[model samples]
Target chain A: MIEPFNVYAARLLPSQELFAQGHRACQGCGPALALRYLLKALGPETIVANATGCMEIISSSWPETAWGVPWIHVAFENAAAVASGVEAGSKALRRKGRIPDKKPTVVAIAGDGGTFDIGLQALSGALERGHDFIYLCYDNEAYMNTGIQRSSGTPFGAATTTSPAGSKSFGQKTWKKDLAAIGVAHHIPYVATASIAYPFDFVEKVKKAAAVEGPALIHVFAPCPTGWRTPSNLTVRLARLAVQTGMFPLYEVENGKYHMSVDLPFLKPLDDYLKPQGRYRHLTKDVIAVLKKGIDQRYNEILEKCEANHE
Target chain B: MAKAAPQSLRKGIEVSISMAEAAMQANVDVVAAYPITPQTHIVEHLSELVADGRLDAEFVPVESEHSAMSACCGSSASGARTYTATSSQGLALMHEILYIASALRLPIVMAVANRALSGPISIWNDHGDIMAERDTGWIQVFVENGQEAYDMTFHAFRVAEDHGVLLPYMINFDGFILSHVIEPIVYWSQELVDQYIGLYEPMLRLDTKNPITMGPVGIPDIYLETRKAHDFVLRESKATIVKAWDEMEKLVGRRYRPIETYKTDGARILLLTMGGVSETAMTAVDALREAGLPVGLVRIRLWRPFPFEELYEAVKDCEVLGVVDRCLSTGGPGGPVASEIKGALYHKDKRPKVVEFIAGIGGRDVRVEDFQDMAKKTLSVADGAPLPPFELVGVRE
Candidate 1:
């Protein structure tokens, strides 16, 4: 059973909300909840380079902002690039005795559109430079802010506005881009995959990323209830189902070594994850088999990497 | 590092290398760049400086011109004195971020080694690149020679970072004409450079202690007003721009102006030009005067927040103002500068008839005789002879 909002607050997050109330985000926004947890772990001594997305639009509509820490929205892309500047600039200032405080942790926050596609070059550059920053990609599947257009991170067969199901075709013919694997290939100090369902796990990953000396990235599985056509309250539930069904594995890769943080040897059936979300409602039995096969292949790959790490 | 030579002591240095040294002297905090032709030498030397520990700056070698400008925006908003350099195609690639940099009020100083835009893909000198970015809301200035290129770079940082006029500035010089030329430059001491360009105090930056939001989305209710405010600031920055030039003059004894005139006093005909072409036209004007023609020269230095009053004052006394353009505006009445000259004088009670002549396009050499011929055509316009709105000088028929 899901905990009540009043009781969950004390357990899931701290009493002080760095991402304050009165934000324009829809109720039960998984990305907003993830943001709240990330901010709680990062604390107020963090400067965020926010890419333009749902979070940017909802938080900084105008004169009002929900962020308690210093934040900047550069463009739809280039959050990692902007965070690179922040990290480099602050380091120079701190070395020159200009910045008084222990250098503020720089973090870049963007939706999947910003991370996996349009912003890939900047992200790659920043990661290669090894700038001391944390980049968070809230994987909400599609371009939700611009009305649910399909992005490179949209899963195979997911029904997006641009990738709608038709009479003879399944939606979203392409698979999601493996952004985490790309980050790992950069040989960065830290890279992890987290889910909104597990707030403590995500928060711990955020804390570890902040403590790392070099660049780090967290690919967060933040579900979009509005875009996915699911009930608002099931956002967290869908995130949990995603990890449990082996569709989205919960893992961390530190210094090119993989560690399965939440390994479920006995994974639940894929329909348990797909049936709850309306995006997968159009899938026929044949399409479901294909999706399950793909998930099994990816899970096997992850299992091999984990075993290789142990060896 | 060695101490800089005094003003009397001249050092022959490559113009691009001098620009890199000028940025170093200004004590820049960050440099983000992607190299293109004619602009590569500048960033190449800057990379060497950072590598040698002569300059304590973060040199970010970005992947593309878009990322270059984007990173500069980031570092500038992060409270760092940021700089970048690019040429023709690179400038075109950075066009979008240019407006955003100005709108966000980041005081980033960039050097543009002006080169012609492509269809045929020429890597030569022209104003097509910077002219293409005319309305990007940056404080744009053109340089005539290596000395001006080095000096204006120092002035650009001061003008751009002024709290009253927090806007990005671009110092443009001809690609090979100035960037590749080695000239005698009086390098200013680091002390003098530091004194002139004081420590930057950003109006708003990323800080943990005092949280702030920058570059927020402006919706319909406030979009027009925000754009209005941005326009007003660019317009009102003229005073600060002049003030910055004035201080540079006092410090280095080198004067600059928006509209610089040569022998225009009591002149009946004026040949107006910009960038390195202005110096060439000045030589032609002197020869034409010796040949008993009342020909003068006017150089447009500031291209943005255009000095309408100063320009009118400079050319109003002349009978015909012949404008030389190195870039085409395409389907307009004339090239960009010539059109602007006509527009500036449109409301005046007594104004010179502006003659638009395009020349030296795509690095074609514009000889002194070319200027003489242009002057003759311009004088014909003053005599009420029929002429097209603009003419391409020395183009093959």
Candidate 2:
């Protein structure tokens, strides 16, 4: 197995961490790593409008804040709307010669619960208006802040507190929502899916999204060891397995054209991605086969779209 | 039949259009809202103004009222003069952000065209909508007619952006009664509006150069202080609200007060009213006066911060205080306004005998006769008659 730190560290962007250390995030937190990479890519010239989630709680607990850049946390479901305001307001002020500095790169950050579920309307509204901002949905799969509850982003056969496995029923009966595809359907300028395990690719995508004129979305696959009931050290390993298994593919859509960035000649087995997490321990061999088939079909669809783009 | 040209209409201007003109005159930077009945005309005209060269602002047609307010919060936090127009259900939908806006101290001005709440759903005029948000901590004021609506829009922008008060303002006008009606209104000159509103200087905003965290979680140890500070500022903002009104009076030569009293001197009966009903109640007072009854009117202009002192000063000398409420509190002592009046006068040494009358609910028209009848019932209550908690006026039974 290739070591991620040794391969990615030599070519890292910078050592200045805008999402600084000494915060209260859980041990081996994957979303924190994603936030760290994003902030480092955007730098301090950014203003973040964050929704209420695990990041908001752990970052700014009181007089203490993990963020070195400007940040605001509104309600649970309006980060995109709030970011729209920030972008529009800055434009108005600059047009009137009120502010001396250039408009900051406005970013809206939210958890999967805030993005794929409650915050979808606000996100859709902001995107349709063509606000110059980037909406980053850090997908941790479940509602980790309020405990392990099943969200719309939760994969099928995963057991959350709300979607517990029983004698007659599976854990989560629904498939994971295709949030990135939904974002692409809005006809936005750019929409991409990246994971924290691949920091260089994630940072490059963030830089690309920031350069886009219209609205852009970057859906990040942020693993949660606490929520997934996995070992603390296996956080990065699980994220890599997810991508290598083709369960969470890395792709980008620019101007409605699909382009695959990380294509594997052979995807690892789905059981390698699921067997480590205690949340999926109850899955039967039959259920695993069905899940593998679903993942393969989705991967094939992405490949077909990529092929069509070239044609 | 061909529709008549707008300029050829009998009335000078529609209230909704004039309110939008006032927003343009104030030089608002952003207008974001969803379309709802009665309030739709205001936002539509604003969008037109933005589309034309008249107003240089961004008009966001948000998906819902929740997003409308959320966008306004962002704009205001970015240190812009943000405004939005909404009505009953729209206001209710934005209820969650109403508190957050005030707590964050974002000076966003919102025009709430007051209307009835749903079920037995109706889009007609009523106060039930705003009454439900009585505790959202936003500075709420009720206006009587189109002239007051136009004037209060200017005043709300100034007062909300005041350095001493940095709070969101809600300028409420009755739905259909004031929002849809065409009435002759005095449009202040753009110069006058510019002088009155001056420039909005935000205390804290989203700036890359100077970053500050806003709306952080208030833990148990510090949450109490946050609430106390919010209450202190809201209660103390009475002075700033009065100062803003006084400045408007100075600028326009028209007197305005938190609680405006009419013919209360040497009178024993006082009819308390708010919103558009005050105009009709004034006629009731005139008719009662001709009949040799010493009846008067107490019109409440400010709905929040209670305006306890001004309200008490108006009703202290009256023998009977007839409070008319358009929204029911249901299971409370009386309607919301009457109950608030009762609570305001509870600790006073010299207080009038209060009688509660609930009228104009679900957009039921409150005529001069209804005000007259309400005063008469209150006089009987003052003359040693049994006082029920409240009476529902205009009910078929």
Candidate 3:
């Protein structure tokens, strides 16, 4: 059983709000809370290059913005590339004494479609070039901003608008793309998997990412209550269930070494995670067994990597 | 006419190299570019300069042209004087971000080596690449040769970064015709260029001390207003462009006008062109004038604002006007240039009979003879003779 929540640990978090309130985010928006935590960790000395997604659309309407820090929203798929430019441009200006010498942390924020699919090439390129920036992907599983379309990040047996549950077919036919592994494959200095459910763990990982010199990527499992067909208040609970089950593992890879942040001795039942969301309402007993087998296998792989590194 | 500068300043250099050198002289803060065919030398030379410590700038060799332009927006928004170069397919790849760069009002300058769009994959010179980007709200200008290419690089930055006119600029020189060719260019000293263009003071930038949001989502209630604001600034940028040209002339002793004429004195017919072909048309004009057919030549240096007044003033007295286009409109009215010219002169009472002649497609040569033929055909069309809506000159059926 998980330890009782420590109310005292909440005092350790930063009090300043870098991401402003009174924005147009949906009720119980997981991505919005994740962004707030992210900005709190990075603090005021940060510049953001945001991609076109739910966070960008909600926070940056004309004449009013939710960002209290320097932020830019370029096109959909090139946030990493744009962040590369910002980092390089800032460095050049600082060296030339054109701007002040206070170096700001450069960050790129994108959704799952911008991260896992359309933006993969630019992300790969920025990573390969070793640009000095943090790439944060708020993964809501599907293109939630565009009315629940299926993305590569959408897991198997989940029904989106495009991947509807039908008579002859299961929902999504493909498994979730391993974005963390893809980030690791780039051999960046820091790569990690984060979830909005654990605010302290998420904030800690972001702080660790910001301390690194070279490229770092943090794939955030941001739950979308609107698209997930879960209770609005259960967004954080669903996120907790994602980690409590093996559906989403919380881990970090620092310089080729793996360390699981939250290593559960026994995973919760897959049904407890899947049965709450309408996206997975069409799953059968055999299909749930198949998903559970895959999740256990992947979780074991992570454990083995952590053990090997501990040796 | 301005007095010539000392010959010691003139150097024989490739047009692409001169453009890169111009960027270095302008003290660019960042350059993000991807390698494409005719535009490769500009970025390659820039990389060498950065590596050699001759230029103090960040050189980002982005993965694609889309990223190149995207990165340019980032750098420019960060208050860095940014520049990039690309060709036909690369420009097409960067088509989407080009509009964003303008709408967000980032002063990024780009050099486009104008080449044909690919079907059979010809890497030759044409206006097809720049034509496709006409409505992208960039301040577009065409250069005639290496010297103008070098001069306009500074002009592009100067006008683009103006406080009142914060827009992206594109300088188009033909792909192989100008980009690969060598010419005697008068290189400006670094100090002189600094004195001419001055430092870039961005009206707004991404700064943590004074944080601001850029490229926000415009809802329908305010989207039209945003578009109108952009259009207003672009239309008003003509004065800034002309003033920059005048200042360059005062410093470098080379004069430029929106519409440059060649021997249009008392001529009844005029051949209008843009880019490198204008020089050849000048020769055709001299020949036609000697033969007593009353022909002259006019070249458009400024393309984006359309130069409606200058063009009408240049060709209003002429009886027949042959508008030479290097690219076709495919199914639309003749060529893109001709269509715009027709639209500009549509309701005028004393306008010339606008005859569109499509030539030099995919870098097929538009020689002096070809221009001469176009002039005679335009004159005949003016004399109550039947003609096609637009003539595809020098194309063998």
Docking class of 3: high
RMSD list, candidates in order: 2.3, 3.9, 1.6
The residue-by-residue lDDT of candidate 3 on B293-314, one tens digit each, is 8788889999987799999999
Candidate 3 chain B minimal-lDDT segment of 10 residues? B1-10
Give candidate 3 regions above 4 Å deviation: A1-6, B1-8
lDDT for each of the candidates? 0.89, 0.90, 0.91
Expressed between 0 and 1, the share of native interface contacts present in candidate 2 is 0.72
Error of 2 at B254 (Å): 0.9
Off by over 4 Å in 1: A1-12, B1-8
Model 3 root-mean-square deviation: 1.6
Highest lDDT model number? 3
The DockQ figures for the candidates are: 0.75, 0.77, 0.87
The DockQ of predicted model 1 stands at: 0.75
TM-score of chain A of 1: 0.96
lDDT of 1 by residue, B73-175 (tens): 8899889999999999999989988988999999999999999999789899888898889999999999999999999988898889888889999999998
Q: Which ten residues in a row have the lowest lDDT in candidate 1 chain B?
A: B1-10
Judged by DockQ, which candidate is best?
A: 3
What is the model-wide C-alpha lDDT for candidate 1?
0.89
